[model samples]
Structures are given as structure tokens and as C-alpha cells.
Target: MTTTLPHFEPFSPDALAHRGGALAEGPVALGSAGYTILNFELATTVLRDSRFQNAALKLMEDFGITDGPVHEFRAHSLLMAEGRRHLRLRTPLARFMGPATVENIRGILREIIQDLAAALDPSAPVDFHGGIDQRLPARVYCYLAGAPVEDAAKVARLSERTLSLLNRDPSLTPVIVAAYDELFAYLRDLVARKRAQGLGEDMLSFLIAQHDAGKLSEEELFNEAAAMLEASSVNTTHQTGLVVWTLLRDREVWQRLVEDPALIPAAMVEVLRLYPRPGVVSRIATEDVELNGTVIPAGSDVHVAVWSANRDPARFENPAEFVLERERNQPLTFSTGSHNCLGQGLAKVEMEEVVRYLVEHFPNTVVVEEGTDIGQAGGRWLVKSLTVDLKP
Candidate 1:
């Protein structure tokens, strides 16, 4: 309800605090790239509007996932699908990652978090990103995907490689291709094993059943499973680091949550708002549409600056600051519309549990540095590292 000037960098957090509110006034055209809608209201409309299609293929081409095993692997991604095909692929996977699934595996995930927390040495500085944040989500998703938990380290490495291919660098194309092959092969074999051994209650098994029912082809099943790993592993892993950084940076906020654990859920939402993993969510305008007095031609690529929108004054009071109990707080972190993140519920459970465990265990945590993997193509900003000193 409070208005503030946009003083932060054009797309940076600081810019969001000061200039974000202005977005509600209108949208801006970014040269040939397309229109960028920063206003909360406009962005919401753009995302939910069926006219703006998911430019998955455009993004893939832009990121160089054009051909090879990686392309084949991504061909059936729920992220890339449209119409009934998107629903067909998304439905079973969504059911697997739905709220019930998260709740069912909550206890198992708690054990994973507790184990990671227990391993942290209070007397030393820990690479919280690698030691816990990264490990926790990867392991949790691995468990959910019915993959081998013991192979988490390997899967994490492969997930990184698979995501990095999105960079679209020519030199790294071969490396990216190899990584995709290795990952696809790994999941393919695992799917085969699950089939031979009989599917279980896990997500991978659910997809396998869908395959058996002739609802999905075997290749689609494998691609979706791989996509699940790539999708779930990367965003959750990096976002966890960002969430931890947000908490540790504001010592008072950290202390408050530690003192009252009930605040964790709300606090997590706020953290996600300020540091949504994917800074920008894009779509292609299916028709020439007039928005906020601007005419967007048909087939024009459009982007929503999520980071800026989350801080729009029109949406939240004191959008820059991390307020745990902000009323009517609905950050576009998980995005909106049909293509919104399906695994958000699971992400919430994972983040809430991991964050609470960290603050509770490492009460005296201090952030030494925040690391982001450079040159990642537009989606989630990868927090490659976060060094934090822990206390007894």
C-alpha cells in the first residue's frame, strides 16, 4: 500500500524497490527482444492469458538445445508441451508431485534434512550451498523420482551439466550433448530397472504406469523423468541457497524465525518473492495485443521481470524489505497460469524444512559470500556457492 521510487538496478533487487511500482503504469519494449512487462497487474494478465504461448522452442533454440540427444530429451518436457499433450504429460507428474505426495514423503525428507544438518560442524565455516542446500533438494527429488539416493552426488553433477546446456555456447555444445546423453542414459536404465523390478509408489513409477496404460510412450516417459530431475534439481537447489542468504543477511530476520518457528512458512514466501530463482519468465505473444497502451505484434517474444514485479509497490508494502507477515502477500515466484511450476508445493515443503533446520541448528550462521554460476541462460539464477561460518 506504500509507494516507493525505483532506485534499484534496472533488473536488480534495489531497482525493484524503487522503480518497480512504476511498471504498473505501463509496459516497456526492449528493442527486438520483445516487450517486458514489469507491472504486477500486467504481468499477471500476460501469464494467465492463453494468447501468450509458452515459447519453449524459442527458448530452447536461443539456449542451443536445438539438436542431438539433449534436443530429443527435451522434446517432450512438460515445460515445452502445449494443449492436451502438455496436460497429458503434466497430469501424472503433477499428481506425483502434488501436495499429497509431498506430505507423504515429508517424514522421509525431514530425515534427509536432519542428516545434512547433523553433518555440519558448528565450529567451522560450511559451504552451506554445497553441504546442505544443494544436497538436501537433490536428494529429496532423487528420492521422489525413485532414483538411487546414493547416486545423488552424480545426479547433481549431471543436473548442473544439463542445465548449463541452456547457455547455448558453441564450444560447450559437445560437453552439453555428452552430459545429456549420460543423464538420459542413467535415467533410461533406471526406468528400465524400475519396470523390470516392478514400479513402486514413487513419481517415476507413476509415469511408468502411465506408459503401461498407453497414456504415454516410453520415450515420453523417459524424457519427462529426465525433465523432472533437471527441473526439480536446478531451481530448488539454487533457490535454497538464495533463501539461506536472504535469512543470514538479515540477522534480525534470522533470529526472529529461529525464535518463532511458525514464521518459517510466511518467511519462505517472502524470501522467494525477493529472490525468485528464475528472475525472468518469458512467453510469445500469439496475437498482436494492446497492453498498457503499447501494441505488441503477433509472434513477438515477451518477458516478465519476475524479480521486479515481486517488488512492485502496487503489490506489496515495503516490497524491498523481507517482511515475514506481509498481508495479501502473493509473490510471483512460482509463476502463474497453466505453465506455473507444478513442483511448487514440494519445493515449499523442502525449503521450509531445510531452512528451519538450518536456522535452528546453526543459530550463529554468517554469510561470508554468495556465489552465482556465471553465463547461465535465462531461467533461474544459479547460486553456485554460499560460504557461511557457523557457531556452537
Candidate 2:
């Protein structure tokens, strides 16, 4: 009763402080009508599972999942699907697309870095973060999935717009919906081409064969790839931006890495912990649950507040500090249990190699202010651009 949203966007540090450990505003009324947010006692019980009946994809309608033909097009991807449907696609997806594969292909990941490096104009102002954030994942998506490189810029643009609405404006659902559709259509073409010519080294080819192997279906193939790119690639892009920012500001962190290259892998996870790309977790409850005299009712929406929980004073001492050497310091940047991000390992590999290459080549990465402000808009904090003076 004491707080109001839009005034306080949940999962932010401010809201967590005011609401007393990230509790939802309660099963209170949304004014006038009988619209009420669900009463949630425990946040994880709902999202820590896909078993709850409330995990239904249709449940998106009651909450903030946007609606539109274009939006609906994206609804079938793995991010939106749960239960048996999710298992069907994700099972095979986990097989070939696992973390080991990403790490093993460090050579390709390095090549991707070299491509970004070549695009740099150290003298000319450029938002290194924005360019790489957009370029890396988009290129990764198209390349790994066997899509067209020509489409990377457009896919990157639409991907950024779609995810921007995730944390804030529910009203902008329409625009987000259109972006989803545009991205899907683009992926669909790539899937078809890969199926036709049989590009055997990449994921798309693997997927095409997997379907023929009874691991995936025609629908599963489409949904999985679209889901793969949209769900997996986007976060890597955001993390690329954030980790770069963290490195530039913390000169000591980079200097340490310069002294020891093997430490880059550990440093990557530290950056992931320090500044999570999503920066928040949102979930909706499926059943009544009781904890600490609070009852989170069935169907109530909840934001899991991983940002706060991972930084919980009880769980981690000095939760805000970036400590690369902290033992047992696994950040919840990727949620836990079943719904944990499937692409997390790939993200780590990509970020580690890129930062390693840059630090080795430049010795120092400093921010350039002019290139970073051009496209700053919305609830987006990932990177508009990052201009850093670097020695080549």
C-alpha cells in the first residue's frame, strides 16, 4: 500500500530497499476492477520449476507477454514454452549445443573477435561496446546457425528492440511484437537454406540432421533455432557490452589480466556476476505457497529478484564488490535448477576470448564519451556505444 510501480520498477536496488527484500506489492487491488496481483510468499517455487500448471504459455496473456501476429510468431520459441513442449526442443538442444561445444570452438570465437577488432577505428569515435555487442551476437547467431551474415545488422537491431520492452513498458508490446516477427522471418529463411545445401559444420546443419534423426521435428527445428538465437544470443550481446564497461572502468582488473592471460576465464565470470546482463528476473506464480507469513497465491505474477538475491547480504558478504577470486561465488546471473540459461557457457567463452584479445593487443581500453551517447534510449542499459581509446 505504501509503494507504486512505474514509480518503482521492481528488481532495481531502489525497489528492493523500499519493498523489504523484493516482495511483490501484494495481492492488492489494481484499482476499480477485481484485477489483483497474486500473493507470493516464495518467488523461486514458481519459476524454479516448469511443473506448475501456471507455467502454461497461455498464462502470458494475463501478465506482460505482448500479443500480436508478429508477437504470436515468437511465442512458440523455447523461452515462452514450458513443460513437455519445452522438453521436446530443449533435450536435443542441450546435446549438440552444450557448453563444451562452445569452449571447444574457441578458435571460431577468436575469429569472431578478430572481425570485431578489424572494424575498430581507434582515432575515430566509436562505441566499441555497442558495435561489438550488436556485432558479436548477431554474427554468432547467423554464423553458428548458418544464417546470412548480411542479415546480422538488421537482426541485431530488432533483437535489441524486442528485449528492451522486457523490463519496463508493457504498453510498447506492439512494437516488440513486430520486432519478434521480423526476426523470426529472417531465421526461417536461414533454416530453409541450411536444410537445402547441408552446411555440416554449424548448428543449423546439426539441427537439420537431428530432426531427421527423430531428435527434432520440422516445427521443433524452427522453434528451436528461433528460440536458440533469440533466447541464447541476445544475453551474450548484452553481457559483451556490460563486461566491456566493467573492464574499461576498472583499470586494475584489466592490468591484472594483462599480467596473466590464463586468468581471463575467471575474470569473465566475475564480470558476469558484477554486472548481469538481464539485471533482473521476472516470474509468475503457479500455486499458493507460504513462507514467513506471506502467502503468494496462485496465478500471481512475480519478479524473482535474482539481482538482489544473488547479492543477498546473508548469502554473500559485500555482495556488490567484484571479486574474481571469491571461492564458491557463483552468481545467479543464470537462474538455477531446470530453467537455468542453456547458453550460459557459450556466453562465458565469447566474453573471455574477446576481452583477452583486446587486453593483449591494446594493454588498456579507455572509454570514448562521444560514441556512447548517440542511441541511448528506453530502459536499455546494455550499451548504446562505447568509445575507448586503444593502442593497436
Candidate 3:
């Protein structure tokens, strides 16, 4: 018997709200983008299963980026690697993103946050997204890559334009192609400069060292650096903005964090659950797989609706409401299993520090609703603008 999955358009305008309603229909759905996993349990299962591979390469192919530097990069990048190859590429980068390393960067995060925040006027509502969130992650990336601090803006722009491919808009192919070319050129020059200055302790220098030690081929070395740089900032930028937008509007929760800063981590997790930046994690089914009594054929595109899974009633109590005290509050915002986000720990610590800074410095800050614009598209939540009255 063939089980007919319900039709779902994950990229719909009201996708965030619609995903919750779709869960009631079933765990799996047929959509234009492909099959969507709607429940937390199944989403986790699919994310952990190696049968489904990252669809990024396929997605690029679909967008007419079949043969080019962009195509070659996607084909060889860590995102497409598997098993031993994946671990090999991931290990060197993992050291810098691990819990201890991320924790040690807290003081540095604080200083960066303070520096970004210092530029804002306390007496007026400011565009928090642009002035702070948009810039912090790139600066952090610059530090990690041992690049000049002055290059932060270009790094942010390249990261944004390159990763904008996730928007799934074919029209942006030209822009995307151009961005990757520029990114490759920028990274190549940066690597050359690092070599001239001699190796250092920064992440890029470490990758260079790995290449010199023969652990990573010269090509693999550039690929690893390019992959890391491309993914470093954009998502973190929006996610940080979302955290502030959600917490500021929820005055009661805002007060709790303000009163007890220890709760910021939990609060951050809750915000991630409610408004995950990467709402959809797309995968390609390499072979026929039966999921929840439905057979997904080979070469099928499987999108794990992270936002929906995080709010699945079967998994989370009071799926709609934000509850800070929920036990086992892990969200798929950073994904799961082997291919999970490498920078999650660092990103979380960055957000927590930002929250902590706000709580200590501007506990009375409130969202200026009129100037704030938050929206969802292509199953991703984005912050267009976030205005906050720091002293209000």
C-alpha cells in the first residue's frame, strides 16, 4: 500500500506557522522542494542517518552552477565529504570550535561586543541588527582566520552573498557565482600573506600547518579555509538578531534574564527553538528509504523542517509557547549528528555574551516595534531590521 503524504510548501510565506499545522497531518509531506520531515523524532533520525547526504551540491547544480570554481568547491568541500574523509576534514577545524576553545574566547567576545556596542547611542533607538549583530560575527571570523580586523566588512559581505545561495533563488546565480570567485581570490591572497608573515596560532595558520604536515593537500587546505570563511558569519548574524528581537519583546522573559543572568543560556536555547535561523536543512536521499511507513525514492530531496521539529508537540511541551525551564531543550537550529554545525558552541557563547552585555548594561532596553522588521522566507527566519531603545 502506498501512503500518500500531504502536500506542503516549505517555502511559503507563512511557512513558520504552517509547519506547526502540517505536523498534525503527518510526519512526512510531499513538497515542491521535496519531502519534508516534520516531527522532531523523525527529523533527528533523518539528520543522523547517513543515507541522506547534504543537498548543497545538488542544490547548486539545480541552480545552473554546474561547472565552475563554485561547482568545484562545493564538490570538494567538507559539506560533501563522508565517513573518514569527513572526519579528517572536520578534526582540524573542530579543535578551534570545541567547548574549551569556545569558552576561552568569552573574554574576547565580551571585548568585541563592548566595542561594537560602544558605537551606539544609548539615548536613541538604534538598528541593533546592522550596528552590532551584522558586524560582530565577521570580526570574530577575522580574528579566527588571522586576517586584518579592517577586512571585517568585506568578510561579512562575501559570507552573506555566497551563502545567500541557501535562499534557493535561481535568479541570484550570477551574484552567487561572482561572490564565490571573489571569496576564493580573497582567501588565496590572505593565505599567501599569512605564509609571508610566518605561521601563527590562528585557525588559518593552523590549516596552513596541517597542509605543510601533509595532513591536508594544498587544494584541501584552501577548500577547508574557504568553507569555514563562507559559513562563518551570515547565519550567526541573523540568529543573534533574532535572539535579541525575541527576548526584548517578551518583557517578562526579558526581566527574568535581566534579574538572573545565569538563565541566559536557557533563554538563548528557547529563542533558538522558537525562531531557528536555518528553518530547513535539506538532504538528498542516496537510496530508497522507508520513513514512517512512507518510501522516499532514491535521489529525492529531503528537507528537515527544523523549526517544525523543534516545535513538535510530541517532542516539546506547549510547542508554541516559549518555556525557559524545559528539560532537554536541544533544538535542531545547529542540526545534529556528524554533519552538525561546527561553530555552534562559538555561536552560542557569542549570543550569550551579547545577552549578558545587554542585561548588565541596558536592562531596560525595549524593541522599537515600528522600526523592527522580522520575516520568514524559504523556511528561514531573517531579521531585516531590529531597532532597540537601549536606555528606555
lDDT of 2 by residue, 100-205 (tens): 6877879987888888788887765566766676688778777777667887788677766666555455577667666767867877777777767766778878
Tell me, by lDDT, which candidate is best: 3
lDDT per residue as tens, model 1, 26-81: 44545345567776888899888888887766766666668766676666577767
Can you write out model 3's per-residue Cα lDDT over 157-245, one digit (the tens) per residue?
A: 99999999988889999999999999999999999999998998899999999999999999899999999999989999999999999
Better of 1 and 3 by lDDT: 3
Q: Report the Cα lDDT for candidate 1.
A: 0.75
Better of 2 and 3 by TM-score: 3
The global C-alpha lDDT for each of the candidates, from Candidate 1 onward, is 0.75, 0.63, 0.92
Better of 2 and 3 by lDDT: 3
Off by over 4 Å in 2: 1-47, 51-75, 80-84, 369-381
RMSD of 2: 4.9
Residue 50, candidate 3: alpha-carbon lDDT: 97
Q: How would the candidate models be sorted by TM-score, starting from the highest?
A: 3, 1, 2
**Which is better, 1 or 3, measured by TM-score?**
3
